[model samples]
Target: MLPCRNRTGKMRLGASIESRPAEVETRKTFGHWEIDTVIGKKKGKNAVVLTLVERNTDFYITRKIPAKAASAVNSEIKQLFSDFGKKPEKIFMTLTADRGLEFASLAELENESTKIYFAHPYSSYEREINERHNRILRRFIPKGTDINKISEEELERIEDLINGLPRKRLGYKTPEELFNEQLDLIYRL
Candidate 1:
């Protein structure tokens, strides 16, 4: 866990991304993920998008939330895990995220197998895959666009476009291809 100073000048505790195993960095494992939020220009009541990307397969999961509040983010994530059914741990072994207030309650996501890690302050590179995905999303949603105006179908289309794109890192295979391959392996195991 890393030591961080809260608004009241008190130290808050959270696990650091550095503590993650080396296998996560090598992208040899399928369950490790990186998470982040994409917010609309109007901060107060505008909606936000919660994004999670698989480290190895580059699979993307993006959800639109009402706001960036910890409760909203946590609830959505919990529902996501629930949708994964009885063995969410097999699909989400670890999550690395930024130290944003919206993710303050991330510890609640932990289970017997799943763990959460926070990147160092001001260090977005720690969650590079998430950051890159967010950038691509911005091309469709763009900065300052009201997320509230976007529909779920529109978001899915954007996600599909991204997943369908080939990546040199994946030897020119699309993210959808690799993600499905990993899912097949997980099911078999």
Candidate 2:
């Protein structure tokens, strides 16, 4: 593919941009999330999988979207954070996403104190934790399946099962334990 540029004519490296400081700045808790969407089915279809990864604990939250556009992603993310609570504090700090137009309307998704940051395009590896969780999810929900039929409850159960699994990085502890401990530490501050 040819290089795509921003309005300035400077080369925009699709998803190859790096913004590690922004990620570091916003991750205030174990639950601070990195967000991405996977396109399923045929091209230009209305199916999407929203993936969120907790920075510190490596726990993930996956929600299936009926549409794959930016507006659809923004709204779904807003609803997901709202489910955490109406308050902005529970919404965690930073959300790192790729430069896809699906997240083009990120500003609209921002609540009072929540900040949004974009990672470089095609750099899903930068968000490796989420990528790993994506693999785990594929065991239950394969790629290219019509994601719209998966209910919210089933998605939650999948999230639960993934979180319940022990991780060697955490010395065989579950994400639940690591996440809770990190939250407790944050609360103590």
lDDT of 2 at 47: 67
RMSD of every prediction: 3.8, 4.3
Q: Which stretches of candidate 1 lie over 4 Å from their true place?
A: 1-13
Q: Per-residue alpha-carbon lDDT of model 2 for 31-72, expressed as tens digits?
A: 467777765676566567899888777777787877878778
For residues 1-189, could you state the per-residue lDDT of candidate 1 as single tens digits?
988756796334368887888899999888999999998786669889999999898888889999998899889989998887777788899998888899889888787799888899899988999999999999998899999999999999999999999999989999899988877777777
- Among these predictions, the greatest lDDT belongs to 1
State in Å the error of residue 8, model 2: 5.6
TM-score of every prediction relative to native: 0.92, 0.77
Q: What's model 1's TM-score?
A: 0.92
lDDT score at residue 70, model 1, on the 0-100 scale: 84
